[model samples]
Target: MKQELLSLILPSRNEAEGLRRLLPELVTLLPDAEIIVVNDGSDDNTLAACTEFPVRVISHPYPKGNGAAVKSGARAANGDVLIFMDADGQHKPEDIPALLEKFKEGYDMVVGARQSGSHAGAHRAVANDVFSRLATWMTGQPVEDLTSGFRVVKANKFRTFLYLLPNGFSYPTTITMSFFRAGFSVAYLPIHTPRRATGKSHIRPTRDGLRFLLIIFKIGTLYSPLKLFLPISLIFFFSGLSYYLFTFVTQHRFTNMSALLLTTSMLVFLIGLISEQITMLIYKDSD
Candidate 1:
């Protein structure tokens, strides 16, 4: 197979020590690939450490979320293939080649699925599982790891979902769902995630978890509203139908509960129809 140039994009914040170790390993693993590091307003010596290596560095005066940094790196990258990895040293550089191999099979995106035993804790593992299942249900295909940051994607195809991405940790969820919704082929390669070399995790589970859930719902509504809307509408419709039947059999009178359920069902279904039309329009424009 002909060799393809790959761009390794790393988003960092206060991870100077981690970069010192990660950069060297990446250079050894991917000698021909270009490294693009986006410093998301790190107060530490992260910027200084990057200058020691031959890397293209972009910096934000104020700290932005991981998603924004990734967007910046993608925009600046010149490679045909884009590989995103966290700067915390959790993702191994050796996994790059495995991810690239999927592209040869005509897959548009390949995610490096972290092994279950590699998780920092049980709670994190459970959350990841839940997110993955939700994504699988929404896309009608298995999503092994919705939160994995280690991924390889066709740069041009991945760029289409930029506008819809949130500047938060859940951006990966949005990207995965968007690709699946657009009928892009996605595959996963199991890989081990090591603990970060230094610096504490920036994620606040309570705050970020809620934001992540919101992103999932937003993507669901945008890509396949019927998946959610249909189930909800069905519940209301069935309840209303049942109530009316019971009233006729017993009191022989229609009740307010019956009317309420019927009205809610109609409203929900109508909203879903409108959302579907809007989604079609968005995709049509992309085409």
Candidate 2:
């Protein structure tokens, strides 16, 4: 395969020590790739560490969010392929070539799927598995990892849906589904990395975890609104129909519950149809 210009975007926030160790190794392996370190209002020596290596550093005056940093890097990147990786040192720079290789095979996006043991804890592992399964069912494709940050994507394609990406930790989830729904090929390559070399993790399960659940629903509604709306509509429609039948057999009259359920079913279905049309229009140019 022919060589492709690659851009490595690292979104950092108070991850000085991690960047200190990671940058040198990355520079050695990816000498030609454009390296960009987005400082999301890091108070630490993150900026200083990045200066040691040949990298472009974009600093946010104040902390925006991880996804915001990604958006910034994506806009500034000048490469055919864009690689997004975590700044906490959990993503191995060596595994990047594998992802690129997958991309070379005509995949629009390639994720570095982490093994079960690679998760920070048991609960995290279980939660990630649930997210993966949910994504798999939603997209009708096997989703090996729903939250892995280590991935390679076609830069133009990745930039097309910038508006849909949230300025938070759930951007990965949003991007993964967007590709699938857009009829783009996605591949996952197994990867392993050691424990973080520096500061603590930024994710708070109770807080960010709740946001993740909402993101799942968002993904459903955004990509395939009917997939989510149709099921609920079916439930209400069936219940209403059954109730009306039972009333006719017993009291010989339709009750308010029957009318309410049927009406709600119709409304939901209509809303879903409208949403689906809007989604199609939004992505029509991409097709």
lDDT of each: 0.86, 0.89
Residues 125-242, model 2: lDDT tens digits: 7877888997888888999999888999999999988998999988999888888888989999999867887898888888787897787687777678888889989999999999
> Each candidate's TM vs. the true structure?
0.94, 0.93
lDDT of 2: 0.89
- lDDT by residue (44-154, candidate 1, tens digit) is 999889988888899999888999999999889998899999988889887887788776799999999988678476667887888788778888898899989999998
Where does candidate 1 have its weakest 10-residue lDDT segment?
278-287
Q: Pick the candidate with the highest lDDT.
A: 2
Compared with the true structure, model 2 gives a TM-score of 0.93
- Give the true-structure RMSD of model 1: 1.8
Please give the clash total of every predicted structure, in order.
0, 0
Candidate 2: pairs in clash: none
